[model samples]
Target: MNDHDGPTPGNLVATVRAVLPSLTPAAQAIARLILEDPAMVARSTITEFSAVSGTSEATIVRTARALGFAGYSQLRFALAAAVAREEPERLVPGDLGPDDPLTDVIAKVTRAESEALADTAAQLNPDRLGTVVEAMVAARRVDVYGVGASGVVAVDMAQKLMRIGRPGHAFADAHLALTSAALMGQGDVAVGVSCTGETPDVIAPMQLAHKGGATTVAITNNPRSSLAELADHVLVSAGRETAFRPGALASRISQLLIVDCIFVGIAQRTFETSQAAVRATRSALDEYMADTRRRNK
Candidate 1:
């Protein structure tokens, strides 16, 4: 369920990251090794993994259980399943190099975006999603916060909510975000979006929102991130990129995927009002355009 309760099959890496912050130093090292290359961990024996990871077998077993596995054997089985599901011959992190032609660039970019969405879907738990949706729909207002690429997502979420007859606001400026968050109370839902989940711009407002008794939510790639720690609900996304690939590109795509789902869920729950709102907005726009044309004529 990506609830950080435990990892599902072929989703070991994401779940491991979700719980990494709570693990001991020794356990964190093992978790990092698995994140770096699960295939290698899957193939390595417990003794070899311990030797390479610089941790004892005892710590390794503890790490496994801490990650929600019954033991080391279960952890290995999950890691192996995750590795076996990787795309064959795919680019490492699906990054485009300087020498790649335009054609390859097009194909590679599309493939990377597609996989990011798919990976996020695989990790997303419908129950978790339902909970977030319920919060948004019931709140008196929804406030979304982000900076840079994530700011775009925040704006989109706010705009969609407004269209569906919900009071929504988005903030990119740190001061204004905190100002709004400070006023939010139990009737508000505050969503902070950050790819790395460590952006100070985002964390500050989220902190304020939480302190003000708002229901806070975090949308991030790293589930164990600081931003995630402040929220009542966490929606984790997936990002696959190389050092050369900009962090904003792949991460933003996954963020948008979650935003889209949230919008749809809200709309589905308020079907009558949502449809009426859309129709009214469309009619108003058409009337404005027609009046402008007549004046020009």
Candidate 2:
């Protein structure tokens, strides 16, 4: 139900990263191989992969299953599919290099962002999305919390909800966010957005909301982080950081894609009200534009 209309082989590296912490050391090595060069791993047989990882075939099978694949063969199939699905030009490593031409920089950035969007779409679970949308629609009010780059996305999410006649607020300040969570209760819902999943500003408010009996949701890149553990529903975005912009998420296209899905789902669930709200909002904007034009004339 995502951009692909359903699940396709997303980034095999992302799938592996989601479960990386739980893997055994030997299995972890093989997992790293999959992450590092999935194309090579895909072409490698069990015996060959075993030799590459310095692990036995038995360990390979266990690693494959741990990664949610049926077996080693299935793992390789997914990796191959993911690699094959990429554009031929994108086959090269996406890392930005120093002293590279400006054109190459542009291409690398576009490639990274494109991969982040597609991989995020692939990893997004439709059932979880439905749950979040349902919670948003039924909530008395929704509070969104984020800081820095994620805060921008939080504002966009809240704006979309408000345009659809839903009571939504975005808080960038920790004090304001915590205050909002303080009043939340059973019928309310709170969402925290943090790329690294460890942002104290976001996590504190969401944890408080959870303790106050409100439904809490987390949208983060790291599924194994504290924010994910705290929220009632966790939405993961597969945005791998690139050397171009190490810490900042830039436009955070992957997270925005997740928000778009949530907003669309909620709008679909309450079509008539949302449609009317959108129309009304648009008319107000049009009127403002007309007034500005008349004044200019």
Candidate 3:
């Protein structure tokens, strides 16, 4: 069995980015060197990498482990594969420098978001997503659980599914979420949204839903997290967090992309009904818009 739980084998940079925050200081030093230039690292020997990263050989091995690699040699091979597939223009976001100007910050942030989305798309397992979508489309009802920023994403997903004539609800409150999850059965679907995949508020409800026999899905950045372990299907997202932005923007963007994918897949599966429902919802909104226009006039 494969011991690594990070990104898929060919996506070394993304795997590193996803686990970077959890690595120790000595390991991070080695990781930074690899991230800065994966191709260079791939070509370098372990001793060279240790010297360049200002870390010991043991630190290098530990860093490799933190990235879900069994050892330095495996990491090196994966890095080589990543280098072969890497695009010249693709940019991986590094730590935000204190003296970066406004323009540079904007560029860096946009690049980070782009990379996160790309990595997520690359790492997504289509069979897993398809299975979840099939379960959701055939479900009697769907319940989504999230807290804080993830709660907002859950609401967005629920709204999308509802607009497409699917019976879906989002719960952010812990008590309410648990209550709702407890009522789910085999024909129901439950989705949990958490970037870190360790949010207790989100994970508990998902666990309840699973125990209740609902098909459980987890959208998270960490595949090794408890949420993923509990889920029937796991959708992974990729984003690197900096000191200034902990689990902010990039994570949200990545999660939203996954939400949109699930929504679109379901909508496509029930095309005619979804189209009719969308039209009906739009007509209802149009009437409200007309009333507001008349009032303004």
Q: What's every prediction's RMSD, in angstroms?
A: 3.1, 4.0, 3.3
Across residues 18-109, which tens digit of lDDT does each residue of candidate 3 receive? 66656688887777777778788889898998888888888888888878778888888887777777632353555578898988889888
- Shift in Å, residue 86, candidate 1: 5.0
Candidate 1 — which pairs collide?
A: none
Q: Model 3: runs farther than 4 Å from truth?
A: 1-10, 21-33, 44-74, 84-92
Task: Estimate the TM-score of every prediction.
Answer: 0.86, 0.83, 0.85
What's the CA RMSD of model 3 in angstroms?
A: 3.3
TM-score leaderboard ranking: 1, 3, 2
Please give the lDDT score at residue 26 for candidate 1.
90
**Model 2: per-residue lDDT, tens digit, 74-99?**
88787788778762233334577788
**Which pairs in model 3 have colliding backbones?**
none
Instruction: Give per-residue lDDT, candidate 2, residue 170.
Output: 100
Q: lDDT for model 3, please.
A: 0.83
Give residue 281's lDDT in candidate 3 (0 to 100): 96
lDDT of 1 by residue, 149-241 (tens): 889999999999988888999999999998999899988999999987888999999999889899999998877788887888989887654
